[model samples]
Each structure stands twice: as structure tokens, then as C-alpha cells.
Target: MTATAPVTPDMLTIPRKDTGGGLPNLVGMTRDAMRDALIAAGTPEKQAKMRVGQIWQWIYHWGVRDFEQMTNLAKDYRAMLAETFVVAVPEVVTRQVSEDGTRKYLVRIAGGHEVEIVYIPETDRGTLCVSSQVGCTLTCSFCHTGTQKLVRNLTAAEIIGQVMVARDDLGEWPEPGTRTEADRTRLLSNIVLMGMGEPLYNFESVRDAMKIAMDPHGIQLSRRRITLSTSGVVPEIARTAEEIGCQLAISFHATTDEVRDKLVPINKRWPLADLLDALRSYPKVSNSERITFEYVMLDGVNDSDEDAHRLVKLIDGIPAKINLIPFNEWPGAPYKRSSNNRIRKFADIVHNAGYSSPVRRPRGEDIMAACGQLKSETERGRKSKAQIAAETGT
Candidate 1:
């Protein structure tokens, strides 16, 4: 009898690279799909159910990049899993630590593209700002990442991996084999999908990653603690509340459509009226969990006292708070940060109007990890190469 070739598993999966088109298939299978995969792989129904639990625990709780690390499983079973599935994380190309104790990482996704993840350490809380896409689709004139054209939506693995990587850096893993509420809470206190891309534009992947993030058997982050920021992707706002059920933040940088159109180009598409209409009807949003409107103050742009009044009127009757972010300038950004006096005046107007408006101090600016300052060095290199080609007429 001829000897059968050894049934070795192929386990060389890595982050998907951008291809200027649709995103790569980087294991976006849902939890149900994973269960089906386990059952189909000859694991008995009961064992398959048990195995899915085991795998999910290892993947999320431990951040294991390989199936072999699941030492509790039979060796052959681990090989079977390796042959079929992959648990991958984006490659860390560059990492920076700011003097203020902030951390920023440039993660390489597939297709030679990259995105940024930032960790801001505060006195009482640590927040990890995670990305949803490779670059961004919205060309918000003020945002550094927005200047780069959208490549593709990041896979669920890529999105969740960011939190895992941050936890690894923070050394906050649960004691090896088990997890408790106290242990998990001590790991990463909060997550905000406020990084390189527009979360609403990449809704499906963002939703999947969030489901995994909130899964009781996995990351177990509370819905109240998670916030999804969008630049008024109006059509999807209600669905985000109904499906994802996380806190909502609108990137409402300007009070009027005329100014908003120039700053956030997507405003021409959604406009303020439609965005507010959706917000008014958003399900489960209440005064206790008010929507957050993020206003980036640009000097002599949207920081006038009159502008703040228009903002208060615009968001009238909506239970919301405002976060006035002083623009954090990147090298080639066209706008300047608002003056301290202007920012304070803007906040005062909104605050006196009986709504909570906080002026956000720019964080991680030294590391290029602050608000609107998250383009990767790899993307900057690519732009330089293109400029050289144009200059040399090659």
C-alpha cells in the first residue's frame, strides 16, 4: 500500500495587505461560523460546543496567536485547528512612547498598508483608541489620516488585536489559565473606536469586532464603557444603537453645514439636519448616556462665541455633551490649533447652556498620536515616493 502523505496543517496566516479594492478575507467568520467549523471538523456535537468555548477563551482571554498555545487540547486536535483557522494580530512596524506616558503603535495590516492605535494613560483611567479601517474614506480636511485615501476596512481580527496588543504592552494579562471580572476589568478599562478610520463606514467589521469584545466569554467590556465615534454617518447611526448598542459620539466639528462642508466633506452627503434627525430617534440613548458631540476647535474657524451658540441651538433637545478638541497639528495640516482663550470661550458657551462641554487637552502630540494626528510613517514614506516621482517626471 502506498504511504499517505502526512496531513500537516498550514498555519502561516498574517494580517491582510491592502489592494486598493475590497478588503482581504482575514478570518471574519462569525462565532456561529466558528461553531459550525468545529462541528464539521469531526468534533462531536457536545465536544464541538465545548471546543468553541475553549478556543474563544484562548483567543480573547490569552491573546494567543497560535493554536498550539492551547495546550489543553489534544495535539492532533490543535493541528486540525491550525490547518483550518488562524488567530492573527497586525504586525507592529513602529512604536513610540510619549514623555507624558502615552503609547502609540503603527500596526501593519495586509497589503503593505498600516493604521495607528493609541493608548492614553490618565490618572484614573486608561483608554485604548482602536482603528476600524486601513486608512479612512472620509476626507475631513483637518484630519491627518483623512488625507490618506481609504484602502479597505480592517478585519475583526485586526480591530480586536489592537486591544490585545495594548494589554500585552501594559502587562495586564489575567493570571495564566483563568479569568475573573476583577482581572478583566484591570486589563483595559475602556476602548474607543476613534482611531485612523471612520467606524460607521466600516460598520459590519466594526460590529463583529465589538460583539467579540463584549462577549461574556471573551473581553467582556461593558457596552457603557465602549464608544464608537462617527463623522455623522447618518443612515447607520440608528442601526449602530440598535445592533452594536455602544455609546455614540458624533464628530461635529462645525455648527453649520456651510462650514462643515469645507472641514468634513461628508457633511455635503449627510448634512446636519439628517444627522440630528437620526440622533433624535436613536434607540436606547438617554440623558444618562447622552451622545457625545466631538467638536475640534480651529482658531478663527469654529471657535467664535457665536459659533458655540449655534452649536447649542443645533443640538437643542438632544441629550448630548460636547468634547471640544483643540486641533492637534500634523506636519502638512492646513489648519492651526485654536488659541486657549478661544477654546475656553467655546466651552463656556456650551456649558452655560446647561449641557456638559469639556475642553479636551491634546494628548500624545509629541508622538503624533493625538486627535487627528495618526497617519503612519509608512504612509508618509509612500507619499514622499509619489511626490519624488511627480517632481522627476518619471
Candidate 2:
């Protein structure tokens, strides 16, 4: 029997969020479509396989931002590929440098849609947190990006391009003299899908980008090094583990339904109990590779000692680590960051319960580069007339 058509819109439109533009070139197509395009361009089955391999390498591994830089391929073949395919990159509209060395890039998608990607440099490693969508569907109250409505899923090219841009800024590209395996691995040490948007919601594109990212001959990053964070998309959780096989982190900011439902709105759809059950059944998860539960402490909200004890009970048997994130406040945010004493007390409760709960240090709050603080910088200039009228009471 013929299958039903995929539930996708024909014209790719940018989401109507406060920031960003429409992304036409990024919408539609799958892995099969990409492969067919290569085959139709006079590439034999064997050579097509080889060519796809090379394209993935150039697109991912070396982080080549331009198609013309793919010098390994012949000139004619490059022209043919260029005519048919697009190696689209999000246009970097603005860059902000934090006092603490965190850099946030405001990338303009097609049609003026924009999203934020953050580069956090450490003494030993540099982590690039990339966004997978224009805006987020989940309205997690504490998260800045959650305030915007869902625009659309980011295409594979856009998702991978964030890393390429970071490599450009960091000067971390692999040189001809330093072409060893160790050298490449150390360049972009870690990738986290925690910047903006829900990754599981855009599963296919995220998965495809990750496949290229983790390919040994391509980006060459290990699956263990890449972590895909979800705001508890329960149904897609198992599939993510089985298909992508990467580290999983859940944006589990609360310990109970009462608090979680208010913070993470999707918690209403997939409640804490259901989310925990799904985590228990996650494929290939083990003690060594424990699932990460991210709990952002909000004052007078979910930062109580009782909440911590309940959190430990909720994941009693699961192999997990709790990341205690002190809430990073943004302008107009409805909540306040829990005090140091409250955060430490909450962590103490979880740690005493035989779980590894680490209090995550706030990294880039000064420049809006911390966890759950990413929003396009361009949004500051584009205030709607309605908003202006409301502000002035006109």
C-alpha cells in the first residue's frame, strides 16, 4: 500500500516570532532526497556513495563554510553540485562578547528570521551550543527562548553551520601540518543541543546533522561527546536514544507536576511520571553513561529541600546525574534565580540521597549566554507597533 504524505507545509515560512526570518531553502527533503539529487547528477551508484562521503566530510569535518572551498572535488563536479544543491549558512548578523569570554552569535535565517548560538570557551574545552529551530514550541516559563512561538525546524545544513561559524571565530580549523585524529577531536571538544528550540521536535533534521557530526570520516566527534537536550518530548525520547545514540539531557526543572506544569508547559502533555518512565526505558543507557537531568532553581518555586528529596525518589533506580542550574534571569523573565544558599541546600539534599548533583556555574549571564538565556540580539531593535503603543499607553 502507498503511504500517506508527510505532514509538512509546501512553502517554507519563517515563524512569526519577535525575531528571525523565513527559511525557504531549508524546508523539505530527507536523506533519500539528498542522495537522489547526487545520483541524478551523473554520479554512478558507487561514485555517488563516494561523493556523498566527500561532501559530508567537507560540510562537517573541516567546517568549510563555502562550497568553493571544497577543492578536493573537480571543478566541473563542484559546479554541477552547486547548481543543484545549496550549502546554505545562516547569516551572522551580530556578535556579542561577554565579560566572561562567552560569545553569542545572532544568526539571521532566510526571510529575516534569526536565532542565537552561543560559544563558551573554557580552559580545556570550547563548547558550541547550537539551536535547532527558529523559535520554540514549548513555553517553558523560565526559559527566554520559550517566550517565542514555534517557527519551524532548522534544516540539517543550518544546524551544522553553527559549528562551522564557531570554528571560524575560534580559529580552531584543522591545519595541514596538524592533520592527526587527536588534533581534530580537540578542536570542537563538545556540542550541546541546548541553545534554542526543542531538538526532539525537529528529530529528523537534528538526527541527520548529528549523524554527519558523529561520522568518523566527517566531523569525527564521538556520540558520547555530543549531548541532545530535550524538554521531555517523551514519545520521541526512546527513538532518539535508539536512532541517534548520543548523550541525553532532560530539561527537568521541577520535581513534581504542580511546579513542573507551570515551568515547563509541555509537562502538561507529558507529565513528570510519564517522562521518568520513558527515561527508565531509554535504550543503551547505563551507569557510566547516565542520563542528565537539568534542574534550574527558581526562588520560591522548585528549589525547596523537599523538592530535592522528591526528585531523588523520582529517579531512584535510574542511572542519572542532576545538573543544578541556577536560573539565569533575562529581561521580563517572570522568575528570580534562587539564592546561593537555596541552590546549595537543594544540591546538598540531592547529593546526600546518593545521586551526583553538581551545581552548574552560571557562565554568560552578563551577555545572555547562559543556559535558557539565548534569544536573537536583533529582536532588541524590532519592537512591534502594538508593543510600543502598549508601552506608551497611546
Candidate 3:
């Protein structure tokens, strides 16, 4: 769907039932939605709003799951809430930690479908890469996750659950009445919607989950620290700026439409020129200083100096930072990583053009948790030896 195209009421409705066995997950719902849900669950109308605030803090701010831990609420009221609702996140099927300290989680959501969430811990900060869909719709040639077919859009619970899951693994949640806020540093500080699926394709769930992440009383991540990356879904660009108001990143892998159409197939729909126009206007709409243009460097495809110059021209007016990602190769992938010299030359061209061009260091390569390799390898390992051989024609 184009970024600007009106999402029909039907399109906004995710097909899965939010309430399970008569108990709804309160993790994803907005404040207003939660308040209404409480009233619907036989809560007194006068107390619903107050109850939502309490429950919201207990679940999000304090990371409390059991209603018994909601000590501020009365015993009977806590029992009533426990009987009527659930606070759930995706279950971690397996977690792999790379040699460089990047942690990749294979998380199972509703319906047994799984997605990947990666946490990269740095000295000063940490970034979590979260998925919006179970698999993916677009087949970006360089992305490993694109090989899998789209399963379904993740619910807001599943989406925000990624953050919670990573926090659980990292032990980053604040403990009550302990050290001051100044004594702590968040291990999962930044979030990027750059995993498994193209986020804009699953817009509403992503937006709502991000809102939960940004809420001051919950995850409390600043809007600046969250980035929503798209493969040039033009119509939704403006809406993303107006509604989501987070940082934006484009999967601008190629300089020209001909090359881009092959690298990012979504370019065939929105194309480079049209995408640039939307990007140029993004800063004013989102009130963000700069947009990130992610250029994956592949050998002999679109990494030429000419392509670099063309890229500079393409994004001339917009405030942008160019991320030069050396292609992270996966099994059966068609491309090779650009040579170090070639990447430096390309970076030099963009740097000379006055854009901050940083070559993204490959992280979590040992565990297949770098830029694109996030399909559950454990699932692939489940195939019989004969089945694997047959698929490979070996």
C-alpha cells in the first residue's frame, strides 16, 4: 500500500482475536482502549480509568506480570483483574549470543509463528532490532528474511513484546526502591524496525507498539532513538511522519530505478524519484533533523563510484545520513560483500558531498544476526538430511 493511501477500516483490523479464552492481553492496548476494555469486563465505569493507569504502570513501568504483585490494588480487585485479563509477550524459543555480544532471540508469537529480535550492546548504548511481521511480504534480494513468505502482521503485544523479551534477557528492568535513576544505564536503549519484515507494510501494529515503547511511564524510549525503516512505501510516508513521528530510514540500496527494482522489489511500485520526493518533505512533517538512507554495499551490482555520486544527487536537498552497510551474505544469497577499498571509495564520495556517511560494522555475524540473516536457523535445522539434500539438489 502507498503511504498516503487510506487504510480501509478492514485493513486496520488484524484477523487474529485479541482476547484469548475470554481474557484479553492488556500489554498492547492504548490507554483509552484499556480503559474501555476494563469497563467491558464488568469494571465500574467510574473506576475504569484509574484502574487502567494502575495496571499500565504495574505491567509496563514495573514489569510486573502477576496481578498479586500489583500491591497497590486491593486484594479482591487484583483477583478480578487477574480473572479478566492477561499481560503477555512472545515466548523466547531460543536465544543466541554472538561473540561480539549481540544477542539474537527467536521468539514464538500466537499461532506458533516465530520472528527474530536482535540486541546489540555497545559501550555507550544498545540497539534492539525488532520485527513487525512474522516473515515478510517484499522480497528484497539482499535480505535473508525475504526468502520466507509473509505469515501475518504481528500484534502490538508481539511487537512490543520483543522489547520486553530482550529486557527480560538483559535484566534491564528497574527494581523497586533500589538505586536512583542516575545509577542505571539501559542496555536496550535504541530500537530499529529493521528486522524480519518491512515495517510500513504492517503499519498500524508497528505504530501502536512504538507508541507503547515511547510512552513515558512504560519503556520510555525517546522518539529520536526509534527508527522505522521502509522500502519506499510512498503513500504511507506522510502518514508515518504525522502519526508515528519517529526517525525514518529508507532501504535505498540502489541509486537508479533499474538497479533498485532488482535489489528492493518494492522500488518497482514507488520507484526512486517518487521516494526521494516523499523523503525531502519528511523532515518538516516529522520534525526530525535527518533521515537515514541505508545503502547496502554489494560487489559489482550498485557499489560503483558513479552510483555513489548519483545517490548524493538523489538526496541533495534532504537532511540525510548515509549508512554504508557492507552486504552480509547468507547461504544461497546471490551477492558478495563489497571490497573494503571499494567501500572506502564510495564512503569518500558521499563524505565529500557533505553527508555523514558511516560504514555500518557487521555485528552478530557468528550467530547470523547481522543486517539480514535472522530466519530461525533452528527451524531450518529441523529439516531431515534427505529433505535438505533434495532442496539443495545435492
Return the clash pairs for model 1, or none: 16-110, 17-110, 17-111, 18-110, 18-111
Write down the TM-score for model 3. 0.90
Range of the 10 consecutive residues with the lowest summed lDDT in candidate 1: 1-10
Please give the lDDT score for candidate 2.
0.77
TM-score (C-alpha, index-matched) for candidate 2: 0.86
**lDDT digits (tens) for residues 292-391 of candidate 1:** 9999999888889999999999999899999989899876677888889888888898999999998888877877889898876576577776763542
Query: Which lDDT tens digits does candidate 3 get at residues 163-219?
Result: 987887777777854553843567778999999888888889899999999998778
How many clashes show up per model?
A: 5, 7, 6
Q: Which one is best on TM-score?
A: 3
- Ten residues in sequence with the least summed lDDT for candidate 2: 1-10
> What are the C-alpha RMSDs, in order, of all predicted structures?
8.9, 8.9, 8.3
Candidate 1 yields a Cα-based lDDT of: 0.80
